[model samples]
Target: MLWRAGLTAALVCAIGLLPWLAHTDPALTVLKARSAERTPAPETLRAIRDQLGLGDGPLHLLAQWLGGLLHGDAGRSWVSDTEVLPAVAQALGASLLLMAGAVVVAVLTATAVCARTLRLGARRRLGARGPGGTGSAVLAALPEFLVASVLASVIGVQLEWLPALGWYGPQWMILPALALGLPAGAVLGRMLDDLLPAAFAEPWALAAAARGVPPKSVARQALRRCVPGLLPNLGLFVVGLTGGSVAVEQIFDIPGLGRLTLRASLAQDLPVLQSGTLALVALAALVALLARLGVRRLIGPALRDGALHSLHRPTPPAPRVVSLVYLLLLAAVIAFGLPRDPLALDTTARLQTPSAAHPFGTDALGRDVLARIAHGALTTLGTALAVSAAALLTGVLLGLLPRLSGPLVDTVNAVPPMLAALLVTGIAGSGPWTPALAVAVVAWSPLATHTASLLRQERATLHLTATRALGAGPWYLLRHELLPAVLPPVVRHALLRLPGIALSLAALGFLGLGAQPPSPEWGLLLAENQPYVERAPWAVLAPAAALALLGALAVTAAGGARLPRRRRTPTPPPAKPGPAQPPATPGQPHPARPVALTTPTDTA
Candidate 1:
């Protein structure tokens, strides 16, 4: 665990070195010098001097790295030629403030939602919170900007309650934080909603509660048992707080990192661009690493138990209760659209014709306005669902197999997913698949790393030893044993991955490196309507709206994203007149593991 955390810090430090490396590279210097009509020799020399701290010596690199860590500065902006420290510093505070604000909101909101599990007679209540609720879903579906916009428009603009711009001041932070925090809170809420109940089933938690603990005490105990998964998301929610800040920043004109990002994007300022991008990447990497570290920490005790005395517990069965919600969602789509496009997207569809048949009116293309918009929903929703599920599956496979080959796992872990995504996308035609595939490939390593780590933690349990003794083959153990034990956390990890999945897809689509014309993806829609931003702002607004909707749905479904871990055990025939307490060892801890014991028929 300590080693993994150290590795995480080291990698972050390495990533911090990239911008400096790029600036100093001879070829890049030559290209830059040529562009500026200067001699590459002097520029290259100067660049080298700068990066190596040649004049500054080790102290310079040390200064920059340390400053970046403590203060976020890597020298002056290579493009802007200003103190990089100030820019980094300025961006840092805003981003952190907004992130911190969101974290507080999400934590508070989710805590309240998860707290419902502790109420009296709450067992009859489900952990599934608001996945099916339209309000949270809609609020979630609304883009951060839109949410902020509406808030500002009503509260800030008309009502004159709060300032609309700036990430500074308590007043400024209010709307942006709400905008960023609420959506994430919704997601986190959904994730823990059902999970809290499941945690209620954990042995230690129930044991604690069975001791006549208060309801709140029981809830807290159950929550602790589930920390193995929840802790990782603490890192993930930070991303949403950071990534989703762009819109809120713009709406409020906050001087935060997201605002800087907006400027960097529009100006095409490479240094600011690179630096801004680097900041985002670094933040994401840090979050991901934090998640990994948290998982490792969680497994420490489990590892100790496994190593000291194997559990040798029986394997449990996989839950057959699949979420039919997807299929039901399909039905909902159909039901929502009576003789309308089931997919709900109308790029060219017009508005407000208001006929009995064409109630929503026709689009610019004269298509069924209602049907076209409806069909459009398919493109965004289907793509999100399919791609997210795919990336998740890929990551899960990669994360769970460290025991298969330790060196291989290390090798995979060493390379960052961002780079992997860049390489694959760079090689394979930098289209939508490039990033999507990149996400699947790159994002997978962490999950794979964590999955394997968690499973390893449980390998020494008596149950595992007993299974081995029962002649259980590796395949059987994997299916029935390891999988169920870690299934809840694995599900949690997948939930955490959904946001990244959506972000990657949206990013690809946004970059014009994704779905092409006529695809109507929210990202592509942004591009298609870029020309109309001034005249028909709805074009941009609509696609942005789509992104928010799809993002919200995914995050919502992920709330109770788990399948049943334990099912009711059938009643055994009435015991004979013998003792009620049976021997602790079941079946004498079979000497030979079953060939297929990876899978089991019951939970511990």
Candidate 2:
């Protein structure tokens, strides 16, 4: 709880200090927003500064803002001069509603997916191909923005099934909710599927089945046991939904907190930004608290009685066929995309359909879509791989140091990548590096936590202890023992996370926080061509397909690595001298020789 409070405080403090840190004058932004045509004189700037309390230092402003927050006063927006509380409150309410709807959808979707797997009796081992298979992987990998754009284009624009934009009524919420929920559902469902087999394999579950308990009842009980484990993840999913809604809200034009905070940050509206940051951090903390409580309540007694068994198992290797297919697809994309020049322009050929002359069509600027996507493969995939590799190395190193684990990991993990990107953009200004930097900041936590855990476990093993006692230096032990044990799993974890990192980078781009225009980064491409969807749907679909394929390939490859077989220590040959003692006594058991008990100090 203290850690959560500190995290919230730190984030709020950082948000308060953004204008100063960025070395930008908030007054100028306000002035620009108010009257873009007029230049600000010295006197005008001074008047605006005084009105907005810019003369005060950041510490002073932060203190005052915190005090006001305690008394139900959230200060006033610099741009609108309106009470920050009401605007923040309204936006928070909309965001909460959207999140709530998404949760319901996620839960239902997960349940359905899990049910199908359970019904088929496909209780695969951990890390093996799950029941949902390729379809679920594709769904899980699809970014919310891409999903929202497609839904908006096809279902909203073409089919006219629902209101594509706005937040006028509950009906208007459907598309945005679906966009956020579907991918999340796929993820949750996949997690549940991974967990269910272990639950079913437990002794109690086996006993119930042996006793002729109804399969449905046993499945229900098994699912209940698994839910506690998933609670923390579900909490994270909720927090992620909040962060992810930035793009969703933008696509749907909803006045949610994500959109509100983004607008406030870009405009340097400190009051609104501070309030929104508070709301987001508070929401994350509260959800985490609730999840912790729920897990405790559900598993407390079982834990006390030692009734619950560990759900963790070594992940089985993915099928060879999956890996081969993924490689082929990846190779095909690179082979087809790399040779062409992405920058060539021909205005007369703009928005042309896919043909022998122009393979992925042209954009509004007459830039070849195929060229951009092919070139974007280098930018997006290369950056993601580089970031993941750096993060993996950093996480492993940090994880090896026991002092750096625990609360720090928890605190840092609470901040989502999108939120971090917003903070980074506020301080450093957006650029191609901004997204990568922000992602790298938050990406190391999970790997660090994983490494620290494995390190602790390995340190407790008999062989490591023996090796340490036998005068093995720290570096030697790490090189021969710990690193070998830790690196493989951590690498696998890093590989699994590569898709998410790529998605986050793309998301930042989609939100205009990454790779500016004409860069042809995948996310930027999607953003640039969104308006042309009605005229040329191919522009949007091309990049989205590429991103989805990239995600699928990464996921497949990560899961395909073969599990290493456990090595066994050979037993020492029995002492030949025992035969002499064995001859001693049929009745008297001989003169019992004093047996010496010795601890084995040899590491090998």
Candidate 3:
């Protein structure tokens, strides 16, 4: 395991080096002047070389990176003349302060939502989709951007309790972190929400609960039972949170790696950009590694073997419930999309003389805002689904492959999703497809790792082995053995990611790198109307509301959809035995005709 982790780290580091390596050529672009700063003067270099036993070549890179690792000496900053160590150190400190609070906010809120969702039995009313697991659906649809805008408007703009656009004291981190963490946390909650129910339904849980244990106790026990399955996800979750740092830090300006990356991009400082990107990747890797180790330690031995066989048992059947769910989804898409004029009648419209002829009323563009909103819903939801589906497929393929733990997987995993995304977009040049593709590409790896890890872990279970032993081919194994075992969690995770993807895409759009003008993306809309926040507010609110509604729907769908309970059939009792005696009864019966043996009839 240590070796696995070390390999993972090395792979991560190597992947993290790609951007830096792109700049390693001396003749490349305009960083020639900045390269000199990375190393000391010749005399100082020689002195340091002598002190460190450097024979130059590629050896120095290792020495430098190693030294940087231990003492935080990450070479030099490109834009700021400050030492990379101190500059990032200060920035990281502030980032951590914010992240700590953000993580807490994310965990608590997500856990609360997950708990409520898991307990909600029916999913219809929970989301905007008209009940029945709609909460997660709504959450997923709303995205973090929507949440951010809403909070920023309600709490920051209207109430004026907090500044709408500035990052100030610790209190400022609250809303920003909530914005950043809520969606992610809700996504995390989905992982728990799916697995926890299965745990509760386990034979062990039943045994525990049959003794009159409280539901809360059953849930904890369920949590305990689900530990091994949840461990890998926990690692992935923490790391992904680290990845999200870019947007959050930028929003709050806490000087973290995220902000640095943004600064790097804006200045086109290759070195800064590379360093900042790699720093985030490394941080994410470290967080995941730590979480992985922690989970392993906590899983321990006794429980490990015990848990191995439980979930490994042959899957009962696919819940027709999910099929019902798909039908419901189809119905929703139609209803939401089909409505060309659902809101025709309005007294407000009649009074204002904005009649049915206008229907959705006129936007500042004189186009129908309602039509645009509906179309925008389809566009946004469609984009989200496309991106999410692509990500999910990519993540599953990469993650499920045993090779995921290898060099390539490690490397891919090591590359921060955001950086990878930017790299792809930068290379692909400008287009809506580029961003969408970039979003898909960036989103795939983490999801893949997550999927693969779950499958790999599940691979060790007795049920998997048993199915294999029963002459199941690899395809059969995948269909009969693997798919059923892993699908639920994957579905949950995908649902969770739905909102994040939308939010990230919108954020990219907001930054002017997403969809081009007139695309009507929520983020672009926000950017379009950002100047009007103090005035009309509707322009900003309209799109922000759309993004929120979408994220909220996705989240509620993912986190709130409980795995349907498997009905247990009653066990039949064994037949009862006839009572009493008879060894002597045989002889007595022989004598019965002669008067009941010894004591009978008058044996007297």
Best by TM-score: 2
Give lDDT tens digits, candidate 2, residues 1-604. Answer: 5755676688789988887776788788889877789888989999998887789878888999999989999998888889999999999899889999999889987887787657643232322334446555567767787789888988998899999999999999889999999888876776677667656665565555545666777677767766765675577678667754788998899998888877787788888988887776777667767876785676555544333454444556666687688778767766786787778888898898889877788899898888888787787888999999999988888888746444455555545456578778777787769999888888887678667655654565556767888999999988777776667556755775676677678668766777666776777787788788889989988887776676666566655343466576999999776444445656553454322211111111
How much RMSD separates candidate 2 from the native structure? 7.9
Question: In model 2, where is the ten-residue run with the lowest total lDDT?
Answer: 595-604
Question: Which one wins by lDDT: 2 or 3?
Answer: 2
**Tens digit per residue, CA lDDT, model 3, 198-255:** 4444444545444555566555555555555565555555544544566555544456
TM-score of each: 0.64, 0.82, 0.70
What does candidate 1's lDDT look like per residue over 348-432, in tens digits?
5444344776544443444443344445556555565676566557656755755442333343333433344434543565654
Runs in model 1 deviating more than 4 A are: 1-75, 120-142, 204-211, 258-303, 306-358, 361-371, 401-432, 438-475, 487-507, 516-519, 523-575, 579-604
User: For model 2, what is the alpha-carbon lDDT of residue 518?
Assistant: 72
Q: Model 3: runs farther than 4 Å from truth?
A: 1-75, 117-132, 160-169, 300-368, 375-383, 402-418, 468-475, 506-514, 548-604
Clashes of 1: 65
